[model samples]
Target chain A: MKPAQFDYADPRSVEDAVALLQQHGADAKILAGGQSLVPLLNMRLARPAVIIDVGKLRDLDYIRDDGDALVIGALTTQRSVERSELVAREHPLLAATTRYIAHPQIRNRGTFGGSIAHADPAAECPALAVALDMQITVVGPGGARVIAAADFFVTYLTTSLEQDEILTDVRVPKLTPGTGWSIQEVARRHGDFAMAGAICTLTLERGRCAAARIALFGVGAVPVRAPEAEQTIIGQEPNAALFEEAGARASAEISEPLADIHGSSEFRRHLAGVMTQRALTEAFSRAEAR
Target chain B: MTAKRDVSLTVNGVAYSASVEPRMTLVDLLRGELGLTGTHVGCEHGVCGACTILLNGQAVRSCIMLAVQADGAELMTVEGLSEDGQLHPIQQAFVGQRGLQCGFCTPGFLMSVYELLQHNPAPGDDEIKEALGGELCRCTGYQSILRSVRDAAARLRGEVPAAATEGEA
Candidate 1:
């Protein structure tokens, strides 16, 4: 069960890492935390001719507060972000969602940008990013460019990043005042991938929903934003009926959800509505408290 | 295929250098090259925690991490838990609490609890369960493991007599 033979290089700088990726193109794999990629390598699911080890790229591992968003370096471990007081205070939804990732050991070695870049449809971060309208930063041979979360995920286990690109960071905008957020998922076990999950965030102005964002995962090829669901509840008084209607709309919007041994498409579709309803109710309650 | 790379790492506070293949996992390095076979390899993927070890003081799956990745790094396998033949409090607590049955997964559980007690010496039942959830154990039904962690925490905090952990009684 050893990984396939491959050349390994620990790039000292981000630019050097990007340069290596450009040179190797499709033959090189970038190593961040190696929580996801190493497993793939062992399984021969991925057999890159070369591996660019970014583990020692200390510059890429950080969490900083920008004026408008929390800029997280790509190498930041999930456990560090989960235990970060700043993330907890400013982005409680992210902090909470991070705890559900895998387990303490996995999180200690899993990186934020790696998860986002992996773009697992059942993963929590992608769905949360879509709901929060986060930006994914990628550096390539051409230059640095920003890709919106919506555009970054192209399909299941595939992303919009070119073969020569490396996802460097993510920009999670700070929630505006009086905004509440929640991510709800129904995984069989505590740390398992959710069968159905929803991320809901809403800003309330004087007891009415001023803005809302709804996104669902584990129900489609890619994490989906429920525009109709968001439209149904925006600018309306938050209530059980409104939440239920929004959830129903989300369930209706997504088409042909994945079916596997985990759960049936019908079950996931049903759980989507249920999870969306619970997420909205919790998010509204939090907003009310704010 | 890439040539073997020379890697020097500190394992259990002892510095050792070896030339390892790039594909050799850290667990294989510990078991095959250095002969520290206490760290078990279960699942060979990241899912099973049998290969868990302290990489820079954080629990990580050694099976999935490359040996070359640990170059110039510090690692602690389950063998490093005790000092001078004395069982570490966690290991002693495992024996005292009957935390092992088949004993295959004990090393992983020990390292995990070692980390938990290092960070939070007074973890509640829920916290203990959450931390232990990372590894799988088919034996002991976990209640004994929970008790073992609590005992380990108490021993570390000086709440229990040191002689009690020495298996004297």
Candidate 2:
């Protein structure tokens, strides 16, 4: 089906894009990879009056290693991120999960910032950001501010970003050398939105769990952080029992999981437990090795 | 009201300028305006890779892109898969390995395989499968298509990548 009529502007610079957004406010939508926004527009799920195409902003697409942090430009496409040598060498989990975002064609066009900005609870990048505790830089009329990953998601389709603000970049710190990460998701098809997914990263010291974080998607309005599960692994050994306990806590801490055509709430909760346990076990093993 | 934007876009190495409505999709412009019908439109959304084409040496969904958005951008269509009247190695592999049944989905598959081979001169079977997973073709079970990609990768690398074998029809 054809999309509703709209005005299109190809802004030559980031400032041009920002000015356009300032003039139009919420009536305008920033077009990046268009993997998410375009589909919504086509289906009339979104009816923006203006579309500011910022895909051509070359300055906004780079992956650089700035000392201790891996800074990714907001417009860096998924393909670029997945193929980044720095990302793969340092934060391989981010690169690995980037490979699973949609599919090859979409990844080639979809941007890292766009996916995070879209803030789909079922999206991989958001869960990745939450799991890794990345920082987002947002620029608006009031200048720019760095937003922490934990505070980024306000609600479903809601973010702390203001209307005139554009996400300029994301800074993700390197995982400690011994840290291990696992991202697992189940979708009806490979490229379809996930039914339920979990991303877990663990750091072990002397074979004891030093730190563990679990971020879940498709289990809540916004991607949920499994706090109770994280608490379970703080002082426990990286053993099967600890994994099982953390998994149970993960499922228990959830008041409700999303129920839709793909799965029941009960099934999602079950999958959460199963995937979290699997991920935690895998992560712990990786931590113990090398 | 503003007039339709006058934009010039280069498609398949040929350049042309046209006045297009701001809302016109790049797929429509390629098929309707420029008269290059290789880019297919399925779902009219990004979910389906049927409208995939190489934009500036990278694959992107034309359905989500406005013709104006692709202005002055280099694009390669399925029709441009050959050079000097010779079939691209990927196309030859698809033909040799029987990657098509109905052929409606063939163009997209070819473009995706071309991309995979470009980035990875030699891709393993799993890598080929991952690259082609985005496109869906019902008539031909993915077995033949996957083989075609492997064969194409072999041919592109100037060394055999995978055997062109079929276990089932």
Candidate 3:
């Protein structure tokens, strides 16, 4: 079925694109890769008066090493992120988690910033972003400002981005060498949205965890980092007992689980604990093996 | 308050231009305006990979992309998989290997396999399965397609292995 009629604008530059957004505001939706927004439009779930096609703005598709982090342009496709030698080596968790986004075809068109801006709680990227404590750069009528990943997702499919702002780039810090990383999810199929997913990253020094980050998706309205879980493993050796306690903490912290055709809230809450335990166990083993 | 945009795009090595409402999907523009009907559209919401196409050398769901989003990008449809009336190696393997039954899923399968081979010149069996997992086929299980991708990979490397038929896994 055809989507409801809407206006389209292909801006040549990011500046011009955000200007169009400034002009149209609530009636305008920025188009990055169209991997998500287009489906929403066709379903009539979204009917913006203006569709700003930013694919022509090639300048926004890039990844650069920014000393402490990798500054990825908003239009960078998940395929690029997942396959980049730099990302795979330095940010293995992002690269490993990105493979779970959909499939090669969808990943080729799905952008990193687009997924973060879309803020799908069930999506893996956003949860990784929150886990990594990345920073998002948003350009709007008032000029550019940064928002931490923790502040980005306000709710399910809802973000802190204002109507007139375009998410320009996402800055993700890289993991130093000898760090352990693992990500896993349970989905009905390989490319289906995850029923529940967990990303675990821990840095070890002298056989003890120096820092740990745990993020979850498809378990709540927004992908949430389990602070209690993070606290449990930090400064300690990751073991079966620690992992079990952290999983229980995560299951306890999830405010209200998300329910859909995939699974119920109760089911996801149960899965959150299971996945957390699995991811933690695997990541810890990798860390200890080396 | 519909807005119209003029977008000139190159499709399957042919240049075309069309002015369409922003609502026009890449699938619509390919079929309705440019007459590239080979890019099939099944699930408009993108769960199905029938509308998959090579957008700037990457496989993407055309149905989920606005036509204007594809402006100035190179595109390849199922129609582009042949050269001078000769089937591409992968396409030949599909036919020679009996990879299709009812054929609604053939276009998507062909495009996806093309991408997989291009990305991994000699992919392992697990890699091949991961690449094809996104596609859903109602016309019998994809046992044949799995064979076709591996066979095509060998043929692309100038090795003609005997077709791995039934119970050959």
Q: Which pairs of residues clash in candidate 1, taking residues 3 or more apart in a chain or in different chains?
A: none
Q: Write the per-residue lDDT of candidate 3 for residues A255-287, one digit (tens) a residue.
A: 988888778888998899888988888888877
Find the candidate with the highest lDDT and give its number: 1
Model 3 stretches astray by more than 4 angstroms: B1-3, B164-169
- Model 1 compared with the native: what TM-score? 0.96
Q: If the candidates were sorted by their DockQ against the true structure, best first, what order would they fall in? A: 3, 1, 2
Instruction: Please tell me the interface RMSD, in Å, for model 1.
Output: 1.1
Give each model a TM-score: 0.96, 0.95, 0.95
lDDT (Cα, tens digit) per residue for candidate 1, span A99-142: 98988999998999999998899999899889888999999877
Predictions in order: lDDT: 0.89, 0.86, 0.86
Query: What are the DockQ scores of the candidates, in order?
Result: 0.74, 0.64, 0.77
What is the lDDT for B112 in model 1? Answer: 88
Clashing pairs in 3: none
Tens-digit per-residue lDDT, A228-287, candidate 2: 999999878777888898899998888778998889999999888888999998888888
The DockQ for candidate 1, computed on C-alphas, is 0.74
Place model 3 in a CAPRI quality band. medium
